[model samples]
Target: MRKRLLTEVEGVVAAPVERVWRALLDDRPAYEMTTELGDHTVAYQGGWWYRGEWSVTAHPEGARVVLRVYNVADRLGWGVPLANRFFVGFGARTRQTFAEGLTALGERLGCPSRLLP
Candidate 1:
């Protein structure tokens, strides 16, 4: 039951943290992709192998959003890597998707946003 790290990406929003937080609450992702919601974090646990979590934190410019994927398999955890090997560029694709999401969120919030390196 180890929550192994998979990949992580981050973005910065040029708006108040509260505004960003409220927007996250008002606009959640697809229901099937979500497993937990908290004051500053949203988590998605899919099947028995994958978990993606997003969190927001105060930043000097405004707020910072981070998305982290994990290997949360309850069994056959060793196969997670073997299975993922077939999905080449999975981490890159995940980062790109998260960056696009941040851009879209910025657009919706009428603020500037940029993905972190």
Candidate 2:
């Protein structure tokens, strides 16, 4: 069987793109990025850093957001396979994580959710 490479999940947030971005990186170390307003996108590549993007668009009620996350970069280093098998187990429980994240984000942002897959 072929090994899984990436795990992607999409969701919509009721808040504005800027709000979503701010909430996403909240309570974390300071970081900066140059991004557009509506179609905002960001990437963090510190050893396969979830590497998620929150795509935002105008909606009648609120902005629609898509959160995509998965392993990115540094996949071919020494002992990488061993590490993935031993510690990371990448792609494992990705769907659950995505669903829980969106639900919590919706509640936190005061955006009603529609159940993520």
Candidate number of the best lDDT:
1
Stretches of candidate 2 exceeding 4 Å from the true structure: 1-5, 27-39, 48-50, 59-61, 70-92
TM-score for each candidate, following the candidate numbering = 0.91, 0.54
Give me the displacement of residue 104 in model 1, in angstroms.
Answer: 0.2
Taking the tens digit of each residue's C-alpha lDDT, what string does model 1 give over 21-107?
888767665557646888799888887789988899999989999899999888899898888889988899998998888998899
For this target, which candidate reaches the highest TM-score against the unseen true structure?
A: 1
Tens digit per residue, CA lDDT, model 2, 12-84: 6777767766776562325543332333555443443335455555655555555555444445544444565
Q: Which residues of candidate 1, in runs, are more than 4 Å off?
A: 31-34
- Candidates in order have lDDT scores of 0.87, 0.56
Query: In candidate 2, which residue pairs clash?
Result: none
